[model samples]
Target: MSPFAMRRRHAFAAGLALPFARTAFAQGDYPSRPVTVVIGFTPAGLTDTMTRIIAGRMGRELGQNLVVENRPGAATSIASAHVAQARADGYTLLMGTASLAINPALQPSLPPRDPRQDLAPVGMAYESPFLLIVRADLPIRDLADFVAHARAHPGRIEMGSSGTGATNHLLIAMLAREAGIQLEHIPYRGAAAALTDLRGGRIAATWATPPDAMPLVGDGTARALAVSSRERMRTLPDVPAAPETLPGVHGTFWQGLFAPPGTPEPVLARLGAALDAATRDPEIVRRAEESGVVMRPGDGGALRAYLASETERWSTLIRAANIRAE
Candidate 1:
């Protein structure tokens, strides 16, 4: 071939490569624009708070802004659905919890695509065990005494939760089923409202987040009966676990991040690494601890497996308890 012809052919090849290279570089950057993290609950809640905090750190790591949007209602199904249908780009993510897994089983009437099927788990942000609390004025001193009193009262005792099919509500319901006791279930707008009534002696007991219950318990406004964890919480070392009394009841609330299904594997990997790093950051750790959230980090594969197991476990419990969401 002539030298001039060869030069022209090479120039043509380079010209064709420019656009492809730009597209490749864009994908490699993963998040060229602001990333949105959607929460299923209202703002100022545990999930919302953690998500915003984690998103901020993730934004720092990725050199892009991470925006958290709260879409609370319909037991998180609304938010989950929004993320599920969003573009598969890593830009959109869901701040999921055990509720993501539990809701499918409890609300069978929910839309077709399941969160487990529509979302790709990225990583876990933090987890906090629930604390069983009663009014400060209640006579029950411990889990044993509470059980005895509930047994004596049967359906007379009442427990409040954020909602009927929430993780907190199911935790108490599971305990009731395992312990062979009946307690009236009262659904509130959120844990804060439920805590208010518990302090006013309107309810017998309610499962609360350690962050929400610890101060009140310490201030003598509420009494801690037990924690809903396999091991006792560090914040309340003296408090026993509910399993200590019921022998087998255990549950905890977890928060994690997920991308819409079909998100590029590389993008997901980058996000997972950012989450793992953020969870280990000293500042993030300090804030989470103050919120009574234990910093438990997991990568994409680990988080996905954990979500799956939680879904199955909650499904069995919800079925056994005959609990359904309207």
Candidate 2:
């Protein structure tokens, strides 16, 4: 071939590859700016705290700031919707919770772009069991006593939850169904307020996350009846699992990170790697343990599988209990 002809052919090939090279580079240099993690619950809650901790470590790992935005309302559907509509870049993320799975089952009329359908799991951060607590003055002492009391005084025992359709509320309903007992449910704006009412004896019991329940139980204001986990909590070993008496009942709330669907696979993998590292960090693990969260890290595929199982489990409970958004 002539040298001039060969040079012309090489130039054509290079020209064709420029756009593809740019696209690949763009993916490789993701998060050139800050990343925003949208949390579905209110600030200062367990989810917010966990997200901020993970975000700080993740920011350090990525050498970019990770901003946590709280959009707490509508049973967490508001924040989730925001992420679902966000650009499918790594910039937008969701601090997904057990509510991510429960919301679809509880609120069937939510919208076409549900979080379960619109968001993709990036990684899981931690898991924790909710504690069934009652005011110290309450006569009930254990799961069996609580059920007996509820059965003896149908509609008289009032239980409180952060809100309707929340994981706490759904778990309570599940316990009720499985125990063959009936209790009045009181929905509060948040878990803090519900705890206040329970302390005041206005409510008989509440399903509280361990962090929230631990302080109350420690102060002698409330008694933790049982943990809603398959195994006992390390910090509260004396307290038995709720399933001990109820037999086949078990539940826990999980917190994790998610991205809008269509996020590049490379970015997702990078985020997952950062999360796995964060979960294993000594400080992060210690802080989570102190906060009553079990540090459990899983990659994108494992997180997705866990979410699918949780969705199915909650769906069955919701249908069986005829639970719907209030």
Candidate 3:
């Protein structure tokens, strides 16, 4: 090629790279202003609480406030969609829950029908398991007894959950399928209401989060039979893992951070680093464990892999059980 032609070709290549260079430069100063982290559930819930803790620390790390705004509705679809549709700039983010995966599988009509495509994962925040608790007065003293009773009285066991298609509800379905028992699921507007009824003996059994279950378990208002995780909870060491009684039955309520799709890689790296550091913070870890949450902090790849596995796992269960959103 002629010298002039080569010079022109080099200029064209450089022009093509300019846009990318600009993006990197902008991302280098990510969060030039406050960053907003949207949550799908109301304040005070596990998701909200954890997000605030982690976001506060992350904000300090990033030198900008991470504001948490709740837009709870449609089982978290509203908040999720808002972030998913926002600009790919690092300013807007979502503190997504397991509902991110569940809503798509259970309610196909909801916005963000594909979490993997709509959101770019920053990192995993934390995870907590549901506690399988029964009425304190029941003869069920352990998971073995609960399973035997459930099997013996199949459809008679009244299992309460937060709501139909909720994570706990799906855990109920998983338990039934794995243990070959039938549970008459009683869906409440929220887990708090369900636990209230469980305490009142209105429901025979229900799954509750650790923070919710610990008080009742300690006070003898309810009996904890098993934990939904594959392993025992650190605080409740005596509560056997559900998988011990019914293998392959594991469930967790987890949260992760996400930026809108197409976010620049540099911005993601910065956010991921902040999140990883926050999760490793001693106070953050202590508070999380004390509240029955385990900090698993990981990078975008970890969150991506987790989201894919969870989506597939729950999608299969929802389809097999014909779960539908209310």
Local accuracy of candidate 3 as per-residue lDDT tens digits, 156-250: 98999999998899999998888788999899988889989888889998988988987888899988889998889887898899888778789
Listed in order, each prediction's TM-score against the native is: 0.88, 0.87, 0.92
Looking at model 2, report the run of 10 residues with the lowest lDDT sum. Answer: 1-10
Candidate 2 has which clashing residue pairs, if any?
Answer: none
Writing each residue's lDDT as its tens digit, candidate 1 over 161-264 gives 98888879998888788888898999997788998888787887899998888878888988898999888877678999888888777888888888876665
Kindly indicate the candidate among 1 and 3 with the higher TM-score.
Answer: 3
For every model in order, what is the number of clashing pairs? 0, 0, 0
Per-residue lDDT of candidate 2, residues 179-269 (tens digit): 8989799999778999998878799889998888988899998989999988888878999998888876788888888886666667888
Local distance difference test, each candidate: 0.81, 0.82, 0.87
Give Cα distance to truth, residue 49, candidate 1, Å.
1.6
Please report, as a residue range, the 10-residue window in candidate 1 with the lowest summed lDDT.
1-10
Please estimate how well model 3 matches the true structure, expressed as its whole-model Cα lDDT: 0.87
CA RMSD of each candidate after superposition:
9.0, 8.6, 6.7
Largest lDDT belongs to which candidate? 3
